[model samples]
Target: MWLNGLNLMDLLVKKLFSYPGRDFKSGRDTFAPFCKLDAKLNHPHSAYRTIHIGGTNGKGSVATKVAASLMREGHRVGLYTSPHIFDFRERIQINGQLISHEAVHRHLSHIFEEDTESLSFFSLLTAMAFLYFREERVDWAVIEVGLGGLYDATNVICPSACAITSIGWDHMEVLGNTLEEIARNKGAIAKSGVPFVAGPSAAPFFPQAIHVQRHNPYDLENQEIARAVLSTIGVHNPKGLKEKPPCRFEWRGDVLFDTAHNPEGFLRLLEALEYHFPGQKFYFAVAFSKGKDFQSCLDLIRPHAQGIFALRGDHEKLVKPEELNLPIEETLPEVRPLVVCGSFYIMNLKPKKGRETLGDWESDDGILSIQKRGE
Candidate 1:
């Protein structure tokens, strides 16, 4: 079967990274070619109502909750997020199920046939999601912006409603150095007549936006944004939708796993840790990808940690543990309240046998293991 063909999948990955697309650099016109591709695909993105979420943090959590809540309300929901922890298929899901391997092969085959020589990995995936959602006849699709909303490939879809979770200094080189600049870029997703909801920093930019009050418990703030977005479409009762996307305060035994790669994310993680495990200290196992403010993140969380374990993962962009200038430990203790965090690459590494597994289990061997099992 096509799903069993490893060579085909390898070829797809190669083609995905071959284009000279902007990895980090941003321009408003950067995604114009992808917009053309979507048009060629017969505008599948227009076939369903969508919710577009953009922010420095909490966007993924808000998107997940919004999709799950809609699904609970008896809507066929399509969810699209970025930087999958293990499988590429995790980026596209319908009602919490990953897109099947056969479906990926079919969509990628079609994309290649359309001359996707200039499309970046994210652009290709976004187009594939539009096609999949339309063909599947979904009632709603929740899309999280991969980067700044203005130039993100997913911006091609005119969403039914829009939200900005929170504004912070991230991707500063591309989004700009100041909070106001970042807010402007993320707030660009707002449409004239569309209902918009935003956190405090971004609320001023959208005059018509309903401001979601920031709360002490970070998840509450995210829930407020999701609730507001759902209210726009008459979806009430968003409580008890407990679909936890991997690596966001996911727990196994005593260890917690989080993809807190930036300063803002780490601050939130620290708050969660303090709330959940009051007066308890954790041993933090952390790593960061390139272009992240790792030092600031570390400094903020250091006070709450008993010790720090520096992790070196397979991804090329990961900052080596030695480079951080912290005293690095070689292995984790058999039983300790640990927090595995920073880059998703660190979470992708195999945990020691004694460590409890939580959420999605990422293989140390790489994509082949998860792809073969079709997880």
Candidate 2:
């Protein structure tokens, strides 16, 4: 219910992002060298198993689903994600409950005693998660890579299972300009022994890196690719994951949300929906900032969507509504529902009467319905 951001949370964010210089050092070793500090960590006492998830988008969502399902399966699950919208503590969850602020401070304070002046904030937190998870003796801890995979601090975990959600162009300055370069960064999270499950697409972290579907034969567009990976590994039914928390096509009114900031990820989202749901009407919520390719993403997914909200969120990195509001296809045939897929911030407007999530599914208010002057 609290909407205001926290001062301490802001401080930690600034501190973690403080070391831009380190990200530029070496392409391959750029992110990993920081992990050497793990030698000093209390690894002997660490009892937490892990699942490392990486990708440009969908990493968080996929990790959330996996962690949630694990918790629902009676496992002691801890989910550590990033870039929280409402609260910083949302990043670290135990059995679906966020680690308390008191716990965060206690952990951070204890770790700060280690003379971390040279350590990035992310490195410290990764250590803290390991320490906390060890203390809690969690069955599994789901770790979402902060940026590129290999060098990311979270890669320190020796996870039992892992996944690369969907790779695309993001953090280009740190990861790389090309998708192949990016995929290499993320692929570092993949180990030789673990079953690496990937989304049905190439990622900028490893743009040129191809995943040959070593597990089972599944249609890439079906979005069952992920489900199949889970099943093949015996994690699906062995832990009672069948009936609870299924891989969903829609949420809260058949609305779909994918952090497909890159063209590749966007294409996959559109394709997966078209394959899984077919001609069913869809509501999309997309968020991106100024420097991103919002235009290309919109163009890629436009055909599959029956309605698009082009949402705007509360993040400072979000693109403004006026700037995102581009000229429409006035005479353009309605191949799909009329909608915009921009920032989610537009939801700040009070809901219209008689709609499900926000009501008033008409063209007057939501971004999908906004008509250009020529239209």
Q: What do the candidate models score in CA lDDT, each in turn?
A: 0.79, 0.55
Number of backbone collisions per candidate: 0, 34
Considering summed lDDT, which 10 consecutive residues are worst modelled in model 2?
A: 366-375
What digit string (tens of lDDT, one per residue) describes model 1 on residues 1-375?
Answer: 555566787787677667643556645555777888888899998999999999888888889889989888889999999878777788898887788767787788888888666567788889889999998999999999988988888888899999998888888999999888898888888888888998765677666789987775577677778888889888877852445567777766666778888888898888877777788888888888888898899899889988887876767878878998876655444447789888877766655765646434543422211111010
Model 2 residue 121 CA deviation (Å) reads: 4.8
Which pairs of residues collide in model 1?
A: none
Residue lDDT tens for model 2, 88-191: 55566677566665567667656655556555555666677777777688988878888777777787778777778666676677777887888787888888
Candidate 1: TM-score?
0.90
Each model's TM-score, in the order given? 0.90, 0.67
Best by lDDT: 1
lDDT score of residue 100 within candidate 1: 74
